[model samples]
Target chain A: MSKGVAITGMGIISAIGNNVAENYQSLIDGKKGITRVEKIDTIHKDVIMVGEIDITNEAFEKKLGLAKDNNYSRTAFLGAVAAKQAIADAGITNINKYKTGLISATSVGGMDRTETHYYNYLTEAEPRKYIDGHHAGDSSQKIAEQLGIEKSLVTTISTACSSAANAIMFGARLIKSGQLDRVVVGGTDCMSKFTINGFKTLMILSDTYNTPFDENRKGLNLGEAAAFLVLESDAVVKAENKTVLAYVKGYANANDAHHQTASSDHGDGATLAMEKALKVAGLEPKDIDYINAHGTATGNNDLSEGRAIIRVFGDNVPDFSSTKAYTGHTLAAAGGIEAVYSVLALQNNIIYPNLNFKTQMKEFNITPQLTLKEKHLDVIMSNSFGFGGNCSTVIFSKEA
Target chain B: MKKVYINSVCAITPQKTFDNTQFLEELIEYDANVINVVNPVYKDFIPPAAARRMAKGIKMGVVASKLALKESGLENVDAIITGTGMGCVRDSEKFVSAIIDNDEQFLTPTAFIQSTHNTVGGQIALELGCKGYNFTYVHSGISFESALLDAKMQLELDEAKAILVGGVDELGDHTVAIHKLVNHIKSENINSNALLESKTQGCVFGEGAGFFVLKNEKQESSYAEVVALNTYNTLDEESVNEEAIRFLEENNIEASSIDAIILGNNGDVNFDGYYNKLTSKTFKDIQQIYYKHISGEFNTASSFGLWLGARIIKSQILPEAVKLNITETSKFKTILLYNQYRGKNHSFTILKQC
Candidate 1:
């Protein structure tokens, strides 16, 4: 049997907090990060709330010690900050010591700058630096450079909200196949007029705080953040004597093949992803103690993911909840954010509360965990479904 | 370990490249800043009802993938992976402009749904009804290389026997306008034959889709063997040569062993130096080739380079239009394709004759 990949360290910077410790504290203290928008000068600032990080672009630039002329986008800056923290937490001072690769996921790479300087490029020569950084891979490239990774397998995945989860899944596969000794896998996304307006056009942006698994649920609140994890091969873990936080036991990616954006009426993709993950981990549904659902509180996602959960676990459903209400929907960063939450759940044996839940979903009898509960958790499953009908499930366990 | 071989290849680029039997017999000359692909009869491959909702990128991707699968003589594969830099830009622009124009009210889900980066892969799966592993990578120029790496890993690990992989992108109005504003697109137009000599600034922006069917077992239609693929997010022009050498060395081959090298030259005065350094230095004596002059430049244009490489290896003939130097090999045994976009997302792919 194949041993699980070891998650030696993790780091995250979101609307809630700057690091893992702070994020965990915020979750325990029941602090929801949703608030009025302050970063982007959007016309809908008064109409829609967001989980915007309080840090300014100047602050991020200062934190990275970059020159003023450097063209690091806000998305790349947040990604570099979070990825650096993850590398430090993993105690990996020399990134090239082993065959290491970096897989960073982001839906918005440098659009914040592009949108800001959209019309300035022709007249102003100074803003031309950002033009080269507008592609989705530019953010990942910046983070890789900051981490001192060169001439290695550095790539980016953008599958909407499931991008980071797929990055983690690919990182684990690389390690398991002996292609890389160590890998940094996660995702980062900064708020942009592109996404904010995009979601608004879909009519999925809730004006108020989202309520997941509730009959009166409206939609999701957009958010911005970055999260990363250091996944190491078993050989590296044994050699370094690393403190294994949790094992990436299993991961599966399945497509709905139903519609471009909408989930299938029966949630076929979600069910397949969960089933495949359980099989890969050599575990049963009953063994899972908690589930970090992809409940964006949007009408489509909640109902589809809820039905998938019910179908996979049958009557023995675990204590599942969505922390999206706290952090809002971070798009590509959603998977990484929840991944950190899952690892923390295993470490603390505490299931996070699914904030702002008043009633059960009308479509099914499934109900999310509303209040934080202390329990001896061994295995936790996390789900992330995205546009393009992409569905992914990742299982994190205490033991490999 | 299962050895994955490329069974078939299909490409829809600015040049007449869709028909694998012909090699750039006719090319579309564009004087404008933006270059659109020489479109095929997409209706023949996709139904009108289903094609109505697809963006140009999705349509190109779906048709290219279907053509590739049909050429490979396979009904479906166990997995599908795709790469795109600017994914469904038309829809993205539509959604963004609608939100701005309509004051963020009265919006629908079609454009927003199609704007996701993985729409191409998801659409292919939906059309084939193949519920298997699917993934989409959207890293700049390395996007397609990332997909290739993923497909290679799965094939070697025995996870799947057959897989479909492709890279696609389409030009959007706002994106092109912003890119022009930033001078990422060429300011002065140049002839396709003189792109290298008239290197002024910025690349000639174009869009296309290229697809390939890879299987563990080699068949009669197999074109080439995927030896190795590697990508670098950032590599200085000074280090590209060393990196390429190291990649080949690690694969138990040498630069001299490569029968031909396909270079991605987009006429960008600032970044084309990277490719020039290669063609003028260690690769000077080797049979050299280039394609961006005809295909134009886009994020996934390297997939066109890969298509050219695979065809060269299979057909064992170098098209005169693609030849960069007079030195020619009698037999095309091994081919190396190097691609980069504006000095980012550098990738090296090596294909061997099966």
Candidate 2:
């Protein structure tokens, strides 16, 4: 069998926690982060609850030591912080010692800044500095600059909600194919009036705490976050004698080719992605110890994803759950944050309960894990489905 | 590594290249910095309902993908990968400006739904019902090359048999006005034919979609084989020559093996030096060509360069309109392409006659 890509370190800054430790603590303690909007002034404040990070731009700038004249958007600032923490956790003293690359994903990019200066650009000059930072690559470039990973392959992926999953898959392949010895793979997205209103237009913003796999689930709550994981090849791991957190055993990306915003009735894309991922890992349906589902608590996602899970696992479905109730749907960063959670579950021999899964779905007989369960686990599968029928699955294992 | 072949290409640029019968036979001239794509009959390809809510970028991507698939004689592909710098910017601008313009009330979701960077790629997959690997790259100039690299790697590994890879970007109203303010767009009107000669500080902005079907095996329509691909997030001016040498060397091909060089010269005086560095130093005697003057410059405009490379190899005829120098070549094979945007995201891709 082929050796799997080894995950050395992981870092994340989501609404639930500022780093991996806080996130793990919250998960074990069942401390939810969903709340009413506090930072951004929006009229829908009454109707929407978000997994908003309780940090201000000024505070972030001060922490990152960003110059006042710096044009770092909320997205870039968060990404740099998470990426830097990942490097430190990995104990990588010389970033350029090995062939290194960074593949950062983002859906919001610099919209946090662009929307603020959109109209002002036509009349004001001070706001014009952000004009160049509006593209999706800008945030990735800033993160790359912050990490000092220059003259290497650095790119950004924006496949809606599954963007970070694809980034991890790409980084794993890069190491597997000997394109690079080590890589930093993750995603970053910050809440913006643009996305808030965008989700509002779709009418998918949940009014209260999200309930996943429930019959009366209303919609998803939008969240903002950034997460990163350092993936190193076996050669690099052996040379550095690094401690491996987990192994990315298998990964796959398949489009539903179904609808633009809605999933297919049976979750064809999700089924294909999971089936293919199992095949890549040389495992069967019975091998997945737990599943971190992409249950956004939306009406369509839960039903479709539930149906897909049933289609794949038939009578004996694994102990599956979604952490979206804890952090809302972080869009592009969902896969990254969840990957960290999956690894934590493996390391700690625990399964964080899928919070807020009260009632069973009417369509499917499968039920998600509703209580915190302590079971020795060997493998976990993470599923992330986004708009455009994009479905991706990554399997993590404690063994190499 | 297994070889990947470019089986089919469809481009909807400012030129009249959409029709297979003509290959830039008549160059369309434009005197404005911001030029829109030569419109395709969207109704012919899309339905009324889908086309009604579709943004210009989505329309171009769907039509271009359809045309490429049709020409390749494939009903559906195993994967759909697309690249766009600012996806559906017109919708982004509309949705954003409306948020401010309307005080964020009573705004519908159509514009916002279509504003994502992956909208074009997602819509293409939905149209064909291709439930395979789908990805979208949104890096500025190398966006197209990133898509190409991903497709090429998959083909080499036999991950997917046939894949549809494309680059699509559309012009937005407010985006154009703001770019003008930043001097990213040229100030004075310059004819498309005289783009490079103007020696302007900024490029002539343009928008279009280019799609190609790549396969692991060669077919009757196979024009060129993907030889090598390389991208750099940053490449200083002096190291460009060494970089080109190392890229060709890694592929075990010498500079003399390069029959023609496809240059992405958008007439930007400052960054064109990267291209000029090669022309004056190593590839001076080789046949050189450029296409941004005709296709106009966009983030993924390098796709147009790939389209032109395939056509040159298959037709064995170079249109005089895109020729940079008078040096003639006896044969056309092993074409090298180099592209950069304002001295960032440099890419080098090579193609060989199949």
Candidate 3:
């Protein structure tokens, strides 16, 4: 309990880029990944934009060298790709060395396959392999198998958009509790007609670009992505002489219980989560130098989260921005992807801009950091909220 | 750290165990490949207006949780956590099929909102108006175990006094069809009695919800103490015995001291060996119990085993139906529960009489 969890490595594949380095470059260059759907055969491609990855499922499968009979779903494919990268980035060739575990998160697990063959499963036997990958946990199990992580705590968390953050939180707790020496924590989610229409029904899908905390914001652009962080216990780090990338200083998850999809006007849950995270880190809000706001750009999230931020920081809020404009709302993968971005911000001492923000939100006098700026950052606070009133906050610090 | 205890448990399985007042005295003999829970009058626990919008998983979870809380004599918990592998599948299927059918047009928010994997936890929070630590784990067979672990940690850390935790999954046409195609669900109907010997590729698929109120302090309602729980992503059949021993040893217990062992024998021939390795060899002398035959099988079905273990500790009675062999013990003080699905996500849970 005394030794803190160390994040030794991180990997990410988002609409903005394919790897951590590419994503960092894209962020520094202010490149956004917003575009209309080109790969999936959806009629809403023209009306709804997405943060879709450039690679196709076939190419992704090729990267993993899967046999034709392999029942890897798109979600599993994305997850394996990112998880392997994280493992490699950690410089650990033998993943099974330490008492390692993998904790992945996903809201849509092999759902793309399920949706594609929903009606045709009876008529088509070719896609039958995908039938077993339909559960929310299947993709994670696949990722673990792909990583050769056997006989470990391989699991998934599907707390909607905040899922990946919760996964990271749980992984940190596991490491802290001495349950596992090292754990790969992150989330993966591929674009699906299910989530696209699901968000559309809520009237929260932005047609063009998302403007977080804007006066007249439309909504978010859903994205497909996978990101993972390799968190190792202090003893493992000491034994392996691991290169520490950053530290998962604190994390907290709280429920609003106000509404299923809506947050309270005052952001009660968000406030409690942020406050608890700060308490966990034994740091005050003033210690945070940067904040990666959840900023889904939805009418509900931005307002609720903004109020929560204001409540925590008061007059001297830290330099903050929402990177969601770069990679639309990745739902379950948001927390993991943002975690990568948070670590990157800490390493590079740069605050990524909140792309597409034009005006200050009227509900509260809070304006986001619109330009990428060079600043010395010590701790970065990231927030993620989801349906079912799930809210989570994780703080990444340069020093433990 | 204070010991975590299972204050009360309420299960909505294929059997009638919702009230916490009865055991499996009368079981519903279902002849279908998929078994649905013997539902209680949900209106007695949840409002119809609220119940109408909930998916079966959410409704069952909420109702079962309310029953557990009521039985435990608590109005609200410090936190609410739930585990579901598919999570609101009816709503997920509805939303997905609607998107494909309408070309992503005319979609309503109801199905979409309920489609999240954590909808049950969120809905429970809303119903109880409990603004506290909330989490939902969707980790397949370990989903319930993950929730239990989280609750245990919170109780040990004194962050929460009482936490409402549960594992729930519901039946849906698309899920069933897909599972059947993948052979995770039995392709053909098999007798429950012959489940373990059917030499089948898949187990009997079922839907159920099991909820428990875990408290840091022991009380009159407390059934048993959660001594320890451990989960593994993948374990060879050869390691089951060692793993069980190591788990008990870590908890400062011995294999011989375990009063009874509850195994998750879902009857999937391909995976049931993980249990057979222990029940048939390592703990051969310990009284063995199983429930999937009666509850059917689901990802979170292990929670039903926990519910049963708690009940056995409290009532000190093992229904003749759940017994694996004619072995009895004078006192039921400690129970060990081991569960896995398709030979992955193995878990060992130890519960002790309060």
Best by TM-score: 2
lDDT of 3 at B354: 88
- For each candidate, the DockQ is 0.66, 0.82, 0.79
**Tens digit per residue, CA lDDT, model 2, A2-68:** 5679999889999989999999999999999999999888889999999999999999999998899
- What TM-score would every model get versus the actual structure? 0.96, 0.98, 0.98
Could you give candidate 3's per-residue lDDT for residues A52-154 as a string of tens digits? 9999988987899988788887889889999999999999998888888888999988889888888888778887877778888889888888888887788
Q: Which stretches of candidate 3 lie over 4 Å from their true place?
A: A1-4
Between 2 and 3, whose TM-score is larger?
Answer: 2
lDDT string for model 1 (B1-354, tens) is 888799999999988789887876666666666788889998999999878878899899999999999999999998999999889888877876676576667778778778778888888998888788899998888788889989999998788899999999998888887787667887887777788887588878889999999998999999999999888767899988888898899999978889999999888889988988888888989999999888888888999999999988888878888888898487899998899987877899899999
Find the 10 residues in a row with the least total lDDT in model 2 chain A: A355-364
Model 3 Cα displacement at B2 (Å)? 2.4
In what order do the candidates fall by TM-score, top score first? 2, 3, 1
State candidate 3's DockQ.
Answer: 0.79
lDDT of 1 by residue, A263-311 (tens): 9878999999999999999999999999999999998888888888889
TM accuracy, model 3: 0.98
Each model's fnat?
0.81, 0.77, 0.87
Ranking by lDDT: 2, 3, 1
Q: What CAPRI-style quality would you assign to candidate 2?
A: high
- In angstroms, the error of model 2 at A18 is 1.4
DockQ, cand. 1: 0.66
